[model samples]
Target: MKKIQLFIFAILLSSTSVFAQSDATKKADKHFAKFQFVDAIEAYNKLIEKGEGNAYIYSRLAEANYNIFSTVESEKWYAKAIEAGASEPEMLFKYSEMLKANGKYEASNVQMDKFASMRPADDRAVMYKANPEYLSKILDKGKKFNVQSLDLNSNMSDFGGTLQDGKLYITSSRNASRKNYGWNEEPFLDIYEYTVAEDGSYQAENLLDGKINTKYHEGIVSFTPDGKTMFFSRESFFENIYEKDSVSNTKYSVLHLFKAKKGSNGFSEVEALPINSQNYSIKNPTISQDGSIIYFASDMPGGFGKFDIYKATLDANGNVGTPVNMGQKVNTEGQEMFPYVSSNNTLYFSSTGHLGLGGMDVFYTKEIDGKLAPIRNVGIPINSNGDDFAFRMNEETGEGFVSSNREGGKGSDDIYAIKKLQPLCDVLIVGTVLDEKTGKPVSGALTTLVDANGNVLASKPANTDGKVEYIVECDTPTELKVTMEGYESNKVAVKGSNEEEVAVTVNLKPIEEIITPEQVVLNPIYFDFDKSNITARAAFELDNLVQVMNKYPDMVIQATSHTDFRGSKQYNQGLSERRAQTTIQYVISKGIDASRISASGRGETEPAVDCKPCTDQEHELNRRSQFFITSGGPKK
Candidate 1:
C-alpha cells in the first residue's frame, strides 16, 4: 500500500490539532498520525455514526484505509470524501487507484479524469491525458511470462523470494507464534528457507538461521555472487533504535539492513549496515553480481517518494559507502522497492510510480552510459491490478519468481514461479557495410545506431569483415548510419522482433572520382539557362572535385564551363566564365587551396553531343562543367 501520502497527511493532521472541536476528532487524529490505522478507523467511524462527519473526517478515513490496502473501504470513503467537498487532489488520485485495484477500470478512468482536470501539470495527470487508452495497450502486450503459484505457499502473506545454491529464501508472516503487528494484524515477518530439489520440486520450508530471524520483522534477504555474504532487513528493535511519536506516545521501530557471513552451520556475524538510521528506514537490499555495489530501497530524506531505490559501493573490506539515490528516472513520488539486478545488468524493480496497470508493478531498465534507460513495464501475466513486486529473474534459464496480492491467491500475498515466454523489447541487430557499386565489404567504416530523434545510442567502426552488431530496444524506431572515407554516407531503418535477431546491409556509393590522364569524370553538373550562379546540384558535383583535390594536395585542376547553342557566343561565353568562377569559389569554400584551381569558358564551341536544330533537352545537357587535371597525379 502507498504510505507517503499518509505520512504527509499525518503531519498535516498533527499540526492542525487545535482546530479539533471534539474529543473524538483529537483521538482519531492521534491514532492516524501514529500509524495506528485500525484504531484510527474505529474512532473516525464513530464520529460519522454520530452524524458529526465532515469532509475532514471522511478524508481521514479514506487515507487511513488506503495506507492499509483496504481497497473497498478506501474506495467507499474516498467517494464520500469527494462528495463531502474534499478538494484535495490526492484524494481523487487515490480513489482512482483504489478503483483500479478492485478491477473497476471504467470507474477508475472516470476518477482519474477528474484528478487530471484538478492537477493537469502533474506527471500522473499528464501521462493519463496523453494515453487514456493505456490499459488497452497494456493488455495488448500479451503474455510475456507464465505464472504459477508456488506449492509451498501458506495461508499467510509470503513474498520476496531469492534463489541461491539450490535454496529459496523468502519472507513470510506464517509464524503464528510471533506477536501480531498492529498494522496488518498478522504475525511479524520472518525470513524462511526452502530446499529446491534437482527434479524441479520444492521441499518443506523452515525458518532461516536463528541469527537472521529475530522477534521483530525480518524482511527479504539477498546473497552475494559467491553466496559467502548475506544481507537482509530486520526491524530496529534488536538495535534499540526507534523514534517516539508525541501524539500516540508510541515508539516505532524502523526497518534496517543487516549483513552476515556464511559459516558451516548457517550465516553469522550479523551487523547492521552503515546506511541505517533511526530517523528513516532502509531495507530490501540486493547486491550486484560482482559484489561491488548494493541496491536497496530507503525512505530516507531527499528521496522522491515513500521508498526509492538506492545503491552504495561496497569496498574490498566489506565497507559500504554513502547511499546514492537511483535518480528521478527510476523513481517517482510513490513507493519503489525490491530491486533485483539480473546477470546481464538489467535492473528489475517494483514501483507504484511509473504508469502501470495498477498498484505496484514490475518494471525493468537497462544501464546505458552509466545511467538507466527508460523504464518499461513487464506487462500482462507478470503484472496485474494488484500489488505485484519482489521480481527476480534468471536470464540464462528464462525462469524467475514474483510476488503478488491479486485475486485467487492462497494468502494476502504469494510468491509465484514465472517462466519467460519472450522479452518485452530485447533485440539484437546484426549488419554489414558494403560498397554500392562493387558489392564488396567497406572495411573500417564507421557505423552508428541512432534513435528516431537522431540521438546516437551506440557507435563503432565496422570490423575487417565490415560486420557490426548492436543490442537495442525492439519496436522502437531506430536507424543505422554508416560512413567511410571516399564513400557516400548511408542510413537505413532498423526493425526487429523482441528477443530476436535481424540482419541489415548498408551500401555506400564511392565519392572519389578515378584519376585519369585527361578530364576527371563526375556526375553531370547541369546549370539552368542563362544562369551564372552555382546551384545545389552544381555545388554537389564541385564537392567531389574538392574531395579529390584535398586527397591529392599537389594536384591542380582546370574547371571549364560550357553553354547551349541558344544564346550569342559572347553572351554565352560571359555566362560560362561566371559559372566557372562560381565553381572555383565553391570548391575553395570547401577548404581546398584556391591556387590549385583555374576557370575557363567555352561557349557552344566544344559541344560533345553536336546536333543541328538541337532539342531543348540536348541544349540543356550541353550547359555543364568538366574538370581537367592540369598537373600532379595520384602518388605512385
Candidate 2:
C-alpha cells in the first residue's frame, strides 16, 4: 500500500548498515536506497541464504518491516536482530517506537531506557530520563476526566466532531451509497451534521451540502464564530489534481485546505488555500476564535515530523498568511494531527509521536509567559490505547468531547462525552440556600454563577436541603445567583482562592413581590476577617442589592462600610473606606449604574454589635457593610 511504501522509505533513510559488506550486501543497500524495499528484502534474504548475514541485515530488516507497520514480522525481525547482538542505539529506539505502536508500552519503555542510557544527549532520550515515570503520571491523570461513548456512532467509522450553532458536524464513513477507499477498505469520509438537542442528544442531519462533501473524502472541518466562514480538508482528486508516481504506477492524492463562505443558500464561494501543494498536504483545519488564525496538521515540507501542527494568520477579508510549524516543543518526528483550540486558548491535539498509553493520544499545551509549557497528555478516560483524536471542550461547563476507536464502542472510532472530574480551579464552594425568616430549605431555587468577565459560568437547580455547589478559578471574582419565586433573587459574590472548599450559606429573605415603606432591610454585607477584599459570603449577600438596582435603575443606594475592634480608630476608618469602595465597585460591575450607588466608611466608632470584650463571632458580625435607600424609596 502507499502507506506501507512511504513508511518504508522513511525507515530506509534512517536505517544503518554498520558491518562489513560484500557484493550481495552492496546490492541490497542499493535496493534499499532506491526505495525498492521488497527487492532489498529479497536481496538481504539471499545473503542470509548464503550464510553471510550479520546483525546489520536483521536490524535493517526489522526497520523496514516496522516502518511499513508490519507488527508481527517487525517484532520477529527485531528479536532476531537483538539475539544477533545488535548494538546500535537507533535500533533500540525504533524498537521502542514499534512496541509502543503495537501497544506494548512496558516493553517500549524498557527499550527506551536502554536507548536513553546509550545516547543521553538525544532529545527524546533526555526527555525520557528527565521524567522516567511519565507513563504512570499519564495513567493517573486520565482518571481526572471521565468519558462516555455517544449513541450517535454507527457500525462504520464515525469520528471528528466540531460544534457550531448547536450543530455537531463530524466526518464518517457510514454512507452505504459511497464507494470504498482502497487504502482502508472503508467508505470515503463525508461530513455529517447532527442537531444537538437542549438535553444534549444528537440527531443526525444531512450532509452540509454537495459542494463540501463530495464523492472523494472530506475530512474534519472548522467554522468561525458566525458559522459563515469555513475551512476544511478535501481530497486532491476532487479537483482532479494528484501526483502520479510513474515507477510505482500509483497516483498520490494530496489533501488540501479549502476555504468556503456561507451565503443565504448554502456554502459557496469555495476556493483552495494558496499554501496547498501537490507534494505536501495541509489538512485538518481548526479555525481559532475571531477567524483570524487557523491551526492545522500538515506534512508541508519544512515540518519537524510526518504531520506537524501549524498555524496561519487570516485577516478580516480572509487573506491568508504563511503557515508556521508549531515547533519541536509540540511536534516530534512522527504524526501529529487534529488540533483544537478551546475557548480558553488551550491547545488540544492528538499525536502518535508523543509517549502515550498507546496509539494516538490526546494532549494539551498552553503558552505561559510566551513560552509553551510541556505538552500534557489530557489523561485517561479521554485517551485510550486506541487512536483518540479530535478533542474539544466547552470551558464554561468543563464538559468536553472527543473521538476514539477504543474497544467496546458502538462503532469504529465513536464520539465520546468527556466530563471534567477535576475542577477548573482549586476553589470550591459548597453550601445551602434557605429562607432567612423560617430557616426552611428553599427547594427548586435556581442558581447561576458569573465569572469576572460577567459571563454566566454555570447554572443549576438547588437540590433537597437547598444544597448548591460550584467550582471556580483562584483569584477570580464569581457571582453566584439564587432565586426562588417568593424570595428576593440574590447573588453570592466570592473571590476565589486555593482554599479547597469554602462553605457558603445563602439565607434568602421571603419578601412580598413589592417593596414596603421602611428602609428595606438586607442581610449584612460581610467582609473577610481583617481584609477589605470581598469575601465569598459577602458576594452572596451583596448580589441581592445588585438585583434591586437592576430592577429599579432609578433608585439610589448608599453602602456604609464598618470594621470591628481589632484595629485603631484611624486605621479602621481607612480600611472601612477601602471596603466600601470595593463593595460599590462590586455592585457596579454587575451592570448596575455606578452613579446610583455611593459608599461611606463608618469606622469601629459605630459597631453593629457594640459589645465590649467581644467574642470572635461578635467581631465578625461587626465587620459589615450596611445599605440604605438614598432616593426612590417605597411608594406612600
Candidate 3:
C-alpha cells in the first residue's frame, strides 16, 4: 500500500462537503477519502446504479479501491474515468502504477509515456525517461546472495530477525495467547527466539522470556556490540498509551522506542526513550557498531516522505539526542524505513521511493572520500514484487538475514538467511605497457580488464607514463590484455588481493618479430591422450599461425608433431601421424594450399629436452608441435 498517498488522500477527505454536489456524492466522496473503502464502494455504486456516475466519481472510486490493493477494481474504474474524459497527468500516473502493480508492464509503460509527455518535469517521468530498461539491469545484477526461508516460520506473519550469542530473535504475529491485531486479522506481534545451529539453521524455538515480547505490535530489534544494551520497537498501546480518534472510534497507538540492559536475571532494566510520541510512530531500531548512534525509522514532522530514516546520537550517559533525518541522499518522497548501520558506517534501509524491481527493496549507501556513493539495491531474491525489508548483515561471515512476504514462504512474512556471493574489496590494478625489445615505455596502449567469464569489465588507454589503472574486486581472478598499433597484443593474468595493489606490465613485441621468431618456439600445442581433435584453446593459438601465413601467401611451412615417452615407438608413430595430419588440414582450412604445408610424425625419435626421469611438465613439453619455415618467409 502507498501510505503516503493515503495520508494525502485523508487531507482531501475534508473536501467532501465542498465537492458535495448532491447527498449521495457527498457521502461517497467522504467515505472514499477517509479510507472506508467498503462504505465508499457501496455509496458510489448506489449512485452509479441510478446512472449518476461521472469521471470524478469513477476516479474517486478507483482511488479508494487502489488504497485497499484492489487492483482489478482500481483498473476498471480508472479505465472508466479515462473513457469519461479524465486525462489529468496525475490520473494517468496513478493508472500506470496500478497497471504496473498488476504486472501489465507494457501497458503501464504506454500510460507512463503519456503521463511523461504531459508532466515532463516530474521526477518519476524523468526517471522513466532516463532508464526505461532498469528492470533488466536489476535482473542482470545476478545473484548476490543465496537466501533460504527459515523452517521456524509460523502459519502467520513472521519477520524482522537479528542474531546475538547464537540466538535468533524474530518478530512474529503467531501468539495464540494474544489478541488478534485488527489491521491484519492475525495475532499480535511478539519476539520469538530460536537457537542458531552451526550450519546457520536454527532450533530450540520459544517466545522471548524477557520483557521484550509484548501484547501489541512489535516490529524490528537490534543490540549493541557488547550485548549490554538492546533497542526494540513496540506499539504505544502496550505501554497503555495512545491517542483516540473521536469520530472514527479508532485508537491510534504510535510505535515507541525502548531500551533494556542485560543482567544475570535476564534483561531487566527496560525503559522508553525520550523520543517516543503519541502523534507519530517511531520504529525499526538498529544501533551503530560502536553504540554511539541509534538509527531508526519514524513518521515524525520535518521528514522528506511519509516515513524517513533518522539517526540519534547515543552518548555514554544514555541520553538520546534530537532525531535528524538522513536527508535527500537516502530519504525520498516515498517511504524509507529500517535503517541499519554497519561497522564501516554503511547504511542499509528499505525504500519504496527509489527506482527498484518493485515494492520496498533493500538498498545500501556507503561513504567514500567524504561523499555518499550511489545507493545500490541489494537485488533479488533478497528482493521481490512483494514487500521485502528488515535487513541486517554480519560483514565478517558475509551472511545476514532479510524478511520478505514473497511466495514460497511458510508464513505470510518469513525471515530469510542470505549469504553474500563475494567479499567487498578495494583493490586497484596499475598496468604498465612497454616495448619487449628496447624495454622502453609504450604510451597510449589500449588496456582491457576481463573476468574469468571473458566479459570485459573495463577498458582504457595507458597514460603518457605508460600506466593504466583500474579497480578490481579483491581475491577475484582477472586477466589484463594490452594492445597497440604495429605491436603484438599481450595478456597477463592476476588476482586483486587485500595485501597490495596488483601491478602488471604488458610487453608489446613488434608485429614483425612475432610473425617470424628465430627459435620457432612458443607455447606447446597440447593434445589430449590419444585424441587428435584440436580443442578450443588449441584452435585459438592455431588462428595466430593462420594470420601470419595469410599475410605472406607464398610462405612454405613444415609441421612436426611428437608423442610422449609413455607410448611405444610403433604406437607413438601411428598416434602422432593423426595429429600431424590434423595440423596440416587445419592450416589448409585457413586458406593455405595443401601443397604449401607438409607435416610429419617424429614418434619418440627426437627429444627437445632429454630426461631419464621426466616430470609431467617435461613430458608435456615433449608432446608438442613445432612450425618451421621451409621457404619464402622471414629469413632464419
All candidates' lDDT scores? Answer: 0.80, 0.74, 0.74
Model 3 TM-score (2 dp): 0.60
Poorest 10 consecutive residues of model 2 by lDDT?
A: 1-10
- Give the best candidate by TM-score: 1
Kindly provide the TM-score of model 2 when superposed on the true structure, using C-alpha atoms.
0.57
Query: How far off is model 3, as Cα RMSD?
Result: 13.7
Q: Write the per-residue lDDT of candidate 1 for residues 253-341, one digit (tens) a residue.
A: 77789999999988899998878887788888998988899999888899886789999998766789999999987887767888999
- lDDT measured at residue 624 in model 3 versus the true structure, 0 to 100: 91
Clashes in model 2: which pairs?
142-379, 142-380, 492-539, 492-540, 493-539, 493-540
Per-residue lDDT tens digits for candidate 3, residues 214-316, read 6666666788888877788877877877766565544556788998888886676789999998778888899898988899988898997678899999898
Candidate 3 C-alpha error for residue 373, in Å = 0.2
Candidate 2 residues lying further than 4 Å off, grouped into runs, are 1-94, 97-104, 117-122, 424-636
TM-score ranking, high to low: 1, 3, 2
Give the CA lDDT, 0 to 100, for residue 540 in model 1.
Answer: 47
Give the per-residue Cα lDDT of candidate 3 at 231.
84
Go through the candidates in order and give the clash count of each.
0, 6, 0
CA lDDT of 424 in candidate 3? 44
Residue 132 shift from truth in candidate 1, angstroms? 3.4
* Root-mean-square deviation (CA) per prediction: 10.2, 16.5, 13.7
